[model samples]
Target: MRYLPIDNQLFVQNRQRLAPLLKSKSLVVVNANDIMPTNADGTMVFRQNNDLFYLTGVDQEETRLVLFPEHPDPKFREVLFLRETSELIEIWEGHKLTKAEAEQVTGIPQKQIYWTHQFEQIFGQMVFEAEFIYLNTNEHTRAGVEVQTRDARYIDAFRQKYPLHHLERLAPLMHYLRAIKQPQELPLIQTAIDITDKMFRRLLGFIKPGVWEYEIEAEMMHEFLRNRSRGAAYTPIIASGANACVLHYIDNSQQCQDGDVILLDIGAEYANYNADMTRSIPVNGRFTARQRAVYDAVLRVMKEATQMLRPGNLWDEYHREVGKVMESELIGLGLLDRTEVANQDPDAPLYKKYFMHGTSHFLGLDVHDVGNKYRRMEPGMVFTVEPGIYIREEKLGIRLENNVLITESGNIDLMANIPLEADEIEEMMN
Candidate 1:
């Protein structure tokens, strides 16, 4: 791993917390994500399953975690199966985790560590003893699963093997546990945000008219890679001019124009934890009068929306309130009038024309991280406060974002040190 080693206590505590939530006599199983295949003989870089990583800091392929708290044998209760290393394998693919190394990294006893080949025999015994089996699968609200994952394959095979064993979805329990950030996880996220901050600041000096949008993206990747980030948490969106009006613009093929604005929706990932940030800047380092108005409107909305991210606030209600704030700012910017807003359908506000996407989303292991949106906000929850206005007709788009942690007292902006104010951005650029 390019990132530094994390303390194992975080994973230990995560397992301890999740154990109580499962049904009695349950056998919990989480498999690592498969090393995905590409064109012939090639494979994409491996990414560990977030749940598997959360439960046991093992970031490798063909790994499995079994949590059978009620097992007759204490040693079998919490077993971690790793792909055993060999001389030939080492020569071909480098060294894999040793038993002692895995034990130290995961805080599991050395005796409980075993080779992946032993999983079928050990898991079979546990399945016979346990009444329920908890299986992990991707259940993110926005997930579109076209490819069959390792977990999916396991579910199909396991059902055929033991049809009588009561199966339960582990996603809900995992989601609930992961929703609240543990104290140790905060530093990893902060590290990612800090890397992103460095990249953004570097771009300020590099961005100018005549530069290609991809050039700006390359600068971001360069900074992130040097600062221990595994490239972007997601595909970096380097949208310039009218391209910025497209929400998911990532073509990054056009040259930046002097009067145009660039919407950079990018982030850095450190130790698997992610930071989601978006910032809009003038291509020529100075916002025109009209551009400044739209930018300020979005900035005001972003600030007001951030303040509403405190504990006890409901997500839907908070977004509705943010919409009202945005509506007012849009009116002030002459994008929408009082009469238009008054007659507009409450369910489908006229503001959708200029400002469409949600103002905030949970940010963590995944860029659009998982958390129950219907539930009220709580302390330890981190969200990205991104509000924007896209004026396609005027070829102007402005978005300002920061990662914020919800606290009991209020909220803490993780990107607070990064430039946000128009004057500050202008000053930095100049």
Candidate 2:
């Protein structure tokens, strides 16, 4: 791992929070994500399963975590099964975690080491003893279907082997528990935001008239890798001019024009936690008068929406209120007509014309971090208050985003130091 070692206490606390949610005499199992295949014997880089990492802090592939909290044997209560490294395997690939090393990486003592091949026999024996099985699957509603995960394969085998055991979904419990941020997770995310800040600051100098969008993407990646971040949280969207109007635009192939505005939706990931940030700036280091007006409108909406991220508020309800705030901004921008809003569909509001997509989502382990969207906001839950106005016809789109953590009194912006105000971004660019 390029990132620094994390304290095992975070994982220990996470496990404690998860164990009580399981059924009595239940066994919970989690597996690492599969190394996705490309054509012709090639594979993509491995990413650890978020839930497994949240519990064990083990980032390697072919790893397994078994939590049988009600077990009589203390060693069997929390066990980690690691891929045994051989001399030949080490020569073919690189160093895999050694037994003692896994112990150091994860604070699960030395005795808990079990080989990957021995998983079936061990799990079968353990499942017989437990009454319920907590199976982990990706229940993220927004999850894309481009690739199948290792957990999907395991779920197939699991049902065939233990059909009698009551199966429990781990998603709901994980969604609820992982929603709350730990003190340790915050530093890693803040570190990621700091790295992202450096990348964006360096970007001001890199971006200019006639520069290719891919070049800006390259510059951001160079800065991210230097700061120990694995490039971007999502594909860097370096869209310039009308290209910026297309949400999720990532084909950074166009040349930025002198007076055009470029929207950068980028962030850095550190130690698995992610920071999401989006900033819109002019290609020539200063915004046009009209550009500044649209920019200010979006920034003001973001600022006002962020102030609403407090305890006891429903996320859906908050966004609805944010919609009203955005409606006024859209009116100020002259994008929404008063007549249209009066007769507009309540289910599909007038703001959706200029401002589509949700204002915020939980941000942490994933760019769109896992949280109970239906539940009310609570202290420790983090969200990104992003508001944008995409006037495709005018070839202008302005989105300003920041990471906010819900506090007891209110919410704190993690990216508060990073420039957001039109004047501040302009000052930095100049």
Go through the candidates in order and give each one's C-alpha lDDT.
0.93, 0.90
State which candidate has the highest lDDT. 1
Model 2 lDDT-worst window of ten: 144-153
- Residue ranges of candidate 1 with Cα displaced over 4 Å: none
- Residue 203's lDDT within candidate 2 is 92
> How much does candidate 2 score in TM-score?
0.98
Q: Per-residue lDDT of 1-430 in model 2, one digit per residue for the tens?
A: 8999999889888999898888899999899988888999999988899999999889999999999999888878888899998999899998999888888877888788798998987776677889988888888889876666788788888888778888889889999998999999999999999999999999987888999999999999999999999778888888999998899999999999999999999999888889899999999989999999999899889989999999999988999999999999898888889788878898999899889999999988988888888898999999998899999899999898999999999989999998888887778778
Strongest candidate by TM-score: 1
lDDT of 1 by residue, 386-429 (tens): 99999999988888889999888999999999888989989999
In Å, residue 174's CA in model 2 sits off its true spot by: 0.8
Off by over 4 Å in 2: none
